[model samples]
Target: MKIYFDYKVQDYLADESFRRWVLDGGFRNQDSAWSQWLLQNPDYAGEAMKARDIVLATQLTEEPFEEGYFDTIRRETMGAIQVKRRFVRPLWWQAAAAVVLVSGLLGWLVFYQAPSPETEVATQENVPAENVPFFQKNTSSAILPVALPDGSSVLLHPHSELSYHYGPAGTREVQLTGKAFFEVLKDPASPFLVYSGEMVTKVLGTSFTVTAYATDADFSVVVKTGKVAVSAPKEKNEATPGNADNQTTIHLVSNEQLFFNREKAHFKRREINQRDMLQYVPATHYAYAFEDTPVAEVFRQIGKAYGLDIDMEESLFSGCELTTNLTDEPLFEKLSIVCSAVGPGTSFVVEEGRIKVLSKGCNQ
Candidate 1:
């Protein structure tokens, strides 16, 4: 038997309104196949939506969606009994029948075995050889800059790749994994979009930095100049990639920075100093906001900046708070200085590029 949900169900799944429906659909705690499949799976929802769009795109023959269009979809969604036979049918009838065949195949794959929820979403794979854009690495800067046919530029950080098509109807699209800085050429007609998993940053003519690493708990965007609009894909979470349910689009004016937490599904925008913008650059001076930051978090940030391993006991910083300047000290030295403020008894061990904060409150 052909496998697929009825058309109404498919449309409901795609409808943004139905997101809440699925959430509250009482599918929770059920062994029901459909419920078990989509209860908390955003990736499943994304796939289902893609299938729905493909089906709808093929079936709609007029400007407006017909009232009983879903009814027709339902009939077509079931087994091929209702499907018109193409070989014996007239030319137009055969063509119409072909649409149902393709739709049914898509329905089976998407509804039958949906892909698992993934933090990393690859938009296109196995791209045609001709469609593949050229890539070159700049080891000196640890930047892999893709040379576009249009003279526009995207400097990909280490471990990043960009792809785009050339010639007319060519759209520049880059897939980012780690981080990248964009210096897009002005092209009002051809908008440039950089897709990092589900998050999409669109630009007309602006330079911006995007950080979306798999290991990173959060994705960030910092605009050096011009304006950039950052939005998530329709199929992905409404919130920024890592955020929970906070669906807010952040518009970065020049010199503004925003961080989207994938785990929390929320983001915050703050006015950053020119110095802060330079921190992400390699070998540049680092910056931090120590306004009531947790001691543990401060150490973690320092570790990331210093490219050193940091290990601390959980209880040490459970309730510790820090208010200090981390402006320009080298990694180990900075940690030593911060430890001194806590107390004299507090000491640390440095071994093999790893720093471990030891002892409790320092004895003055």
Candidate 2:
């Protein structure tokens, strides 16, 4: 059977949650990895297949593709890489060894390592679910500001999907993919369960963003308020009636982030700042007024919304800093403001769904 994934899902494959899902008993080894990668990278089937072919052809003596070509290819097809720690080592020794190994590999393995043979992801067909009527089901592309039965507000991403059933059950459960931001209404008795990629996040009530785009290179859960418990699929190996895959759970507090990468087969948690949180949050209905916001961020936002390419030659504006308010301007006006920041000679153009920043003057 064959399943198709788009770019959004491909990008999320590097998520820790996705990795956990793959390693969990949910899918057979190859199928699981393939499923995870396909889910995160729907738009990248051809490239993914090519990478998988190369990985399977491991030990081939063909010189690696040109560094730039391979770099670009890796950027488009790569997922996170994680090395399993050796438990026999003492904590301090393990930490030191990890530092040394990671420093040596640096971005090579983390972002661009060649995929292993076993890591090749295969496409699959959905195991059809019976009894769900077509009429009652919502369309996939529907973008709605949904109020969960428990009162939480969710801004669903374009083309992402959610499925839920509500009743007297003690907790509410929902399956999600793509991206969404939740402003959950508190309900301690009815903990909220969000199934994304391979990980499940349980929360009582809080604000958080769950990004599991099938094309994204990573799966990320960022908590902006309250707490969350992140864990692998319920254990199929648990000896007791109640115990399912019960792996260790990572508790995340506000400002904490969790990532699950399927190819890496692990989960990671990190501390994040406000700036990190703001990037994933959906654009506000109104523009933000900035006083001393970094110019780089401004350029970034414009580039994203307008599909503009930024070729910044100088580090000057990256940290040069700025003080400005953008509350009332249109997007183009905002672009104009940023263009003005880097002196008069620089210019910006919007063409064919892309914005290109050209230099009449600045240089590195």
Candidate 3:
């Protein structure tokens, strides 16, 4: 119990005793040990108070999710805590929100923004009988493919869980825990939304992979094709007119990846790794050969083969030609050879995991 004094907010929130204390409304007889410890360690009082609020806000009451989902979340959360115990010490509140968000409990506390006047009127007019949410769990060893009513397909990983409910207007809304690949069917009238923790990914017609296992320190969304939008949950206090619709939104194109660090509440965007992109096109076989091929065409082929977004000044390489037979080389190796072939002093640099071609115009 002494170790709990040093525990972060997430740790306390995950602890059974602490949860009991919170649920019991801090009754002196209910958890005297925790109360006494809080008094003794006044330094941790602020953290403890915040942890209590989070627990109260995110506490599960009626077991809306399946038992298997709960089991998986508990196991992953404990495993992540153990792994994080070594090598890093995190801020109490940050880690607390991270854990709660990963387990999908953040929905109870956050993400319940007030609707606009128009939305509120519509909701009042279209209120239907209480709709039971649909919960799906993949507890088996193999990947489970689920076909949604809206024609979208989800390949849920083992031990992952997804909950979804179609709204009265035919909009598709799903919440996910763990990893899944989604092939969304385009619907101009009804957009698709997937919620994972404190993040929301919206797409009309796109293929993307979201890895959000509860035990992982970070969650990621990788776009394979089409366009997608990712945004963080809006703070309740910051919800204002007009701005509410686009809070912290980031648009992603093909081969882009966005990573959200739970402990830091920070996001890092970059190009997806070439090898990772290759997984999306496993059946495509490319012959890396170019004989007097225009440099632009060569770059296009390379980008297509690897699903990377290679950026350069096309006009600068308008007349440039490259002749090479590249085979079985890693992405950077192939890029290095191509740069050298383009011209002397032509080079490429990787910035934020994206390739930038640096070169003088081809000798006229």
Best of the candidates, TM-score: 3
lDDT of 1 by residue, 135-233 (tens): 433334444433343435455576655555543455566667778776665577777777776677887766678898877887888886566888753
| CA deviation > 4 Å runs, candidate 2 | 1-143, 215-217, 233-246, 282-364
Ordering by TM-score: 3, 2, 1
Cα deviation of 230, candidate 3, in Å: 0.4
**Which of the numbered candidates is closest to the native, going by highest lDDT?**
3
TM-score of each predicted structure versus truth? 0.37, 0.37, 0.40
The CA lDDT of each predicted structure is: 0.55, 0.53, 0.65
lDDT for predicted candidate 2 compared with the true structure: 0.53
Model 3 clash tally? 0
lDDT of candidate 1 at residue 191, scale 0 to 100: 77
Question: Lowest lDDT 10-mer window, candidate 3?
Answer: 105-114
For candidate 2, which ten residues in a row score worst on lDDT?
A: 122-131
Over 1-364, each residue of candidate 2 has an lDDT whose tens digit, in order, gives 2433432334334444443443453334546656566556656656555544444344336867544666534532331111122222344444444443333222112112223423222100111121121111124453344434333546566667676544246566778877777766556787888887777888876667888877766688888756788876433444245555455578887678888775554678999876776766544333444556776666776545423355455455665555554432234334544555444454454323234555454211
Arrange candidates by lDDT, descending: 3, 1, 2
Q: Which residue pairs does candidate 3 place in steric collision?
A: none
lDDT of 1 at 27: 40
Worst 10-residue lDDT window for candidate 1 reads 119-128
Error of 2 at 59 (Å): 61
